[model samples]
Target: MIDARGPEFAQVLERCTVLLGTLFQTRNDILVFPGVGTGGLEAAVVNTLSPGDPILVATSGVFGDRFARLAEAFGVDVRRLSIPRGRAVEPEQLQEALEENSDVLAVLLTHSEPSTGVTNPLAELAPLVRERGHLLIVDAVSALGAVPAQTDELGLDVVIGGSQRAWHMEPGLVMLSVSERAWDASKRARLPRFYWDWRHAKNTPDRFLAPYMPALGLFYPLENGLHEIDEEGLPRVWERHRRLGAFVRAGVIARGLQLFADPAYASNTLTTFKVPDDLDAGALRERLAETHGVLLGEGQAELAGRLLRIAHLGYTSEDEMRSTLDAIQLAIAAERADDPT
Candidate 1:
């Protein structure tokens, strides 16, 4: 207990959190909470929005819909713009939505579309939201630390990310950066909150972390992860993720599979592929893991049995991706031979 709140540890935590913000180039203050990325999602909502505030959700896939549902649970007036599962929400589309929803208080968007493997245009969409004078909140649970997110430059009001994805930490830690505009919104926000309160400890003079029980152990690993990212250099890390994404896409294409998401907006952390004709998605994944020891991402609700996903992020090398590709190829070949048709 003392270790978690001591001045030395507090300084270390502050340094690490700030480093995480640097990865996004944000100058905003950060709030570290104990929970999953969903907690950060809720915090972003409750901390800055009243129950009746009309907010727009730009959704394309499973996680995006999940966030919209979370907002609905909080009683927010959620208006969702549903893009097709494999495509991104363009800036023009957002502009049109905002124009139509003149009373929109904020726009909730997922930075990296993990379920469908599309990376929404954050850099472009930022100005669009700013131009319309609405707050911007992003779910970057699987995007941060592996992709480019210029929080300050993009003028995002609240940016939410998790420790598990690119930080490679065990789950239950969610990080948030709240801009000044969001802080102002918090003061007027009417949503009920206690443990998720952002102002209590965040602005306190000597507070080490949050005002409540914190995920104390994650701070140490978070510091180490930030150090690793710093040592590797951000640009190099970003480039590595890009190359890995391309490699996986090429691998799937060489296997005669179609990519689910448009290549122009594909995410660097994950890639989605359409289920091959007459092939069972789940069985294909099972055969890959059982016979070749290669594990692939399972599909979400509607996408289930219709597509498969390949996900990788942080510290992964080319050889590992090659291994995954080889395993998938062999699995497919076996599945084909077994089927009579």
Candidate 2:
């Protein structure tokens, strides 16, 4: 392992942060943490809000619910505006919720709902929150590089991302792009924090060093991944994901499977579909993995055994996606032949 405190490492980190800003389309300060995406969510909560501070959480799927639950755990008064599974959170709905809860200090929104493969309209929703003088914290863990999130243009306060998502890196690092307003809010906010404190993690002494040792091993890979993203170009990357999403959705539909996410707001990174009522979702997934060497994500919580998610994100090629779709078709056909209604 390289010296984490050395200047060489610092340079690598600084470059990664700059690339991260490019990915988020923000010139704001980007903070890196040595944990998973959920840790970034926790950091966003504790850094900007005090205990009992009311906030509106717009939830469209499992990840959204998790963020609301996380805020509740921090003693933040969470007013959850839940949308139906597979449906994006409408701007009108958020406007109404904000009007109803005028005392809310901030708005927690999931940019891309991974569980249901729905991508919320951040451009439409950001103005509603910002116009009301509320902080906008976005969970863009799965959406960052794959989707277009103009953080600076949207005036989002805090946007969280993960290294493992669109970057195709390992799961040891999380990033948060914090706006100037968010930094000011952190000064007055009072909620217990030690490890996740942005103050402690901020670059110090012009050396780009953190108070504590970060995920050293992840830094190199993170830098390399960011460079790869830079080489590909962000706009082109987004277009690729968009095309992949459309291709997967069309393939699924041709196979007679209904999509779980609204067609208008479907995610570019992943596609969720309903499992036929007669077939066991778990067994079908098993058959796909064991026989076809393809693994699929299972539905979470109440939707378990009813939906399956296919991811087309992170360095995946169209050929790979086509093969995955073919595998799904074969697996479903085999399962049906074995248990005919």
Candidate 3:
């Protein structure tokens, strides 16, 4: 319903929320704004709780670690549950953390840790937070469409999504859903917030649509992306990701490469592998892109020189999978040839 002249941003925002709800399988409305998944996280923290509020963070990777830092920046009291990089935090550990921190107002969790390719057990973990009288907020940016997330059924208080990871779109906009639990908490939060504030944006439509200009063109492609998911169905989409993940993992093992994450906790959307000591993943990534036209993501931070990531999400095909394997084989062979010791 966007016209070139009148209230295009308003109409686009309306459609955007519907498309996001469909993508995330949520009944609540989604907010659209500048920045990617990180922006959505900021909004959730700034609006839903106040300074000095006790927050419990479950971190298994770099992105999860960011939640702790951001919460601290807002002057919130943070109790952290840090797990090994390649392993998911157990439900028992989370339960213990909550037990020890009885004053925790909220719990932050990451659904999929793309950095280490680990998937947390949110379904099992949410109930613990609820039982302890704490709100659960999930950073499901990578898991949202790529993996299955039933937000309402899981009792998640807030969930965040993005366009780049699973939606197969540009990275400017982030989508977030606020549950009734979070809505009630926001009533008493006294945090200083402006662009990331949810009060005015949630209660007043004009405030949401006025100064904040909507990304109109992104809406068109997001609609297309949601339609693609609808056509395939969420179950089929999840099955495809799992199948592809297995295919890629099998290929890596066949080539004698070591997997970074444990088999049971590994993410189905992405697979991280420890680069063979004989090979340089950075150079191999460049060669694969230049020689084979296959673009793969490199590792980050502490994992930089050690791991390589395969992103098998969103409109991914089996043919592309085969091509990627072939390209990786070529890179491995080339590396082995250079130093056949």
Candidate 4:
């Protein structure tokens, strides 16, 4: 049914409406979706930058790390400000990194690092980028909807979002924003692209917002989700994420687990904690799910097995967080009883 060309066009417009609402929420102009999250990142790197263009990439966790890798993949010269996991990048460090790269075209960073449960200071980062006359590209995929971003005031040139996160929609749909500077840079960049050309997508209204036909069925659910956020009020939805995150973190600390992130910078969508060195983190996750039917996220890279992530995002509530914490404590106690060392 969706394969029909006529219906696909209308659905594509619906997709655009949903995307425009999400991107505009960040307060940026000219939203684009080269493909999805990764595609949006690629387009940012390829379209707005020439090979060997200087750029500063702020890396705190997995997504920020991906930004550096993607920049290098497009042959852009990358200068990294390596903030340690669980910490936000200070403005002073960004100043130092920028001073070292005088020709920087853009500064890339994640608004929220889902892997490390760290939310960086994008409000601070954006102005610094603007002061240096460099565009700020934000990976707000996990931050948008779940977090509050005043895109216009922040001076961010490009912002990215994915449908799977707080948007509460199916994957495959992605959102992006482009500013005037980013659009101007497109003229000189020589990256090989086909379906990802933003100029083409922007010009050809008939082909929909993207160069290719998208997942049309996703628009139906995505529209519903966006409308739900609109009705609830975006700020109120963000407040829900904030309050639940704090409640969960408080409960985790109450249960005697060490929080992995600084409370000031802790992501309002999720929290991570270091399992007591004596406890097996992997076993803790399993018993919680098998015994209590509660699923939680695990850490990545160096944090794997050392930490466990607790998500308080996406249609979750305070009661749910309390129950999740209760289950976690039970799981740990059960694991200790079965094998005490």
Candidate 5:
């Protein structure tokens, strides 16, 4: 690993920040931290909100729920606007919540939820929060590169991202694009924070140094990944993900499997399907990995054992997806044949 404090590393860090700004479509300051996307979520929470501060969370799936829980852990009064699972949060729902919770300091939203393969209607939902003069914090970990965030145009105050998602980089790094309003909130925020302080992260003598020792190893790869995304062009990359999502969804339906997400708001980065009542989701995943060498994600929390998630995020190919689908068909066939019923 290179020395994080060195001039060369500082240069690399600056370049990455600029590239990340392009990715988020923001002119705001970008901060890097040495942790996963969750850390970025926590940083957004601690830096902009205080204990007992009221905020509205629009939750559609697991990640949205997780954001609510994270804020609650900080003693924030979280008013949850729960959308039905497999459905996107409607703009009207958010408007209603904001109207009811006028005291809310900010609004938390998940741009793309991996658990249910649903991407919330951020473009339509963001203005509701902004028009009301509330800070808008978004968990864009799964959406940034795969979909359009338009952080600046949307007036999003804080947009969090992770390296391991669409960037195709290794985990251990998280990035945030912070608007000036978020910085203003930070000045008044009463939440206890040290490592996650945005000021420390921004005001360091060398603007590139993090609050603590940085993830020295991830910077180069992160830069390289950003360059690759830049070279491919954002529109083309997004279209590729869109096509992949369509292909997977169509292939799954053709195989006689049912999708779990609403077709109107299905995620372009991943797809989730309802597992047949007779097949064990975990066993099918195991068989896919062990017998077919294809891995898929299991449903989380309440949906566990009843849903299957297939990711087509970064560096995925149609050939690979076809193989995965074939493996799923074979695994299901084998499992049903052995069913004593």
Candidate 6:
């Protein structure tokens, strides 16, 4: 076990944390916590917003809704501006929401909607939030490592990410970067928080320790993953995901399956497709896993059993893409043969 306070562990922790800022192009203060990505999101809100504080949420998919729900659960006044389940939020709509709500403290968004595989145009949306004089907080858990998310450049107040997605690391670590404005908001925020308090993370001079000890198991994998990212370089990694995403989407289109999200808003990290109406999505997934050894992500919430999501993230190669496509095609073909349609 490594000492959470020792210099050796501190060095590695800093290395991993710095890599997140570099990945997202941010110079803001960062906090790396040991939990699911949602915890980081909760930290973002609990640290910066108080009860009844109004926040506008621009949601295009399930995760964005979840962020808004978290705000509502904490008694924050949530103003939802939503698109369909398989779409991206438009800047104009968010601008309209800002116009409608003059007391909004922040605008919450999901950078990449993994449920429907849509990546919102943050560069366009952030300006709208900033123009309205509100802080922009984003859940980038599924977007950061696999796509071009210029967080600081867009003037975002907080960008949250998880280690597992597109980072080539297992779950257990989540992180967020905070801007000067976000820190100021936290100082004024009256939310009750102990573990999720941003101060505990930002209090120490080095910004390494949590309120308690760090996750030693996650720390090692995170450090190694950061080195892997550093070695590959961000541009190359993003381009690879882009090319692979197109490869997956092309294969899906060639198979005559419809994409769940619009092509323009499709995510480079994952692609979602409309599940054939005649087939049970659960059966399809089970056969693919039990028979073909291919595990696919299921649809969430209302989209469950109606959508199929596939990934083209870090460490996934062209060969794997071909395998995934072939497996999906075969699964669909088998279902058709059984139904005679």
TM-score, every prediction: 0.96, 0.98, 0.92, 0.93, 0.97, 0.96
lDDT of 6 by residue, 207-258 (tens): 5555577778777777788788878998998899889889989999998889
Angstrom error of the Cα, residue 201, model 1: value is: 4.4
Candidate 2 to truth, TM: 0.98
Query: 175-197, model 3: which lDDT tens digit per residue?
Result: 78888888888788888888877
User: Which runs of model 2 end up more than 4 angstroms from their true locations?
Assistant: none
Top candidate, metric TM-score:
2
Two-way lDDT contest, 1 vs 5, winner: 5
Cα lDDT of model 4 by residue, 47-153, tens digit: 77878888889999888888899889888899999888889888888888888886888889889898889999888777878987887888888877788766767
lDDT of each: 0.85, 0.91, 0.81, 0.78, 0.90, 0.86
Which candidate has the top score in lDDT?
A: 2
**Candidate 3 total steric clashes:** 0
Q: Name the runs in model 5 displaced over 4 angstroms.
A: 203-206
Instruction: List pairs with backbone clashes in candidate 3.
Output: none
Candidate 2 residue-wise lDDT, 206-282, digit = tens: 76874478778887788888888889999899899999999999999988899999999999899999998989999
TM-score of 1: 0.96
Where's the lowest-lDDT run of ten residues in candidate 4?
26-35
Regions more than 4 Å wrong, model 6:
203-207
Candidate 4: regions farther than 4 A off: 2-8, 11-19, 26-35, 203-210
Candidate 5 C-alpha lDDT tens digits along 1-341: 47778878888888888888899999999988888989999999999988999999999988999999999999999999998889999888888888999999999999999989999889899988888899999999987898987999999999999998755589899889999999999999999998888876783435666557887888888999999998999899889999999999999999999999999899989999999998889888998889998889999989899899998998799999998999999999988887846
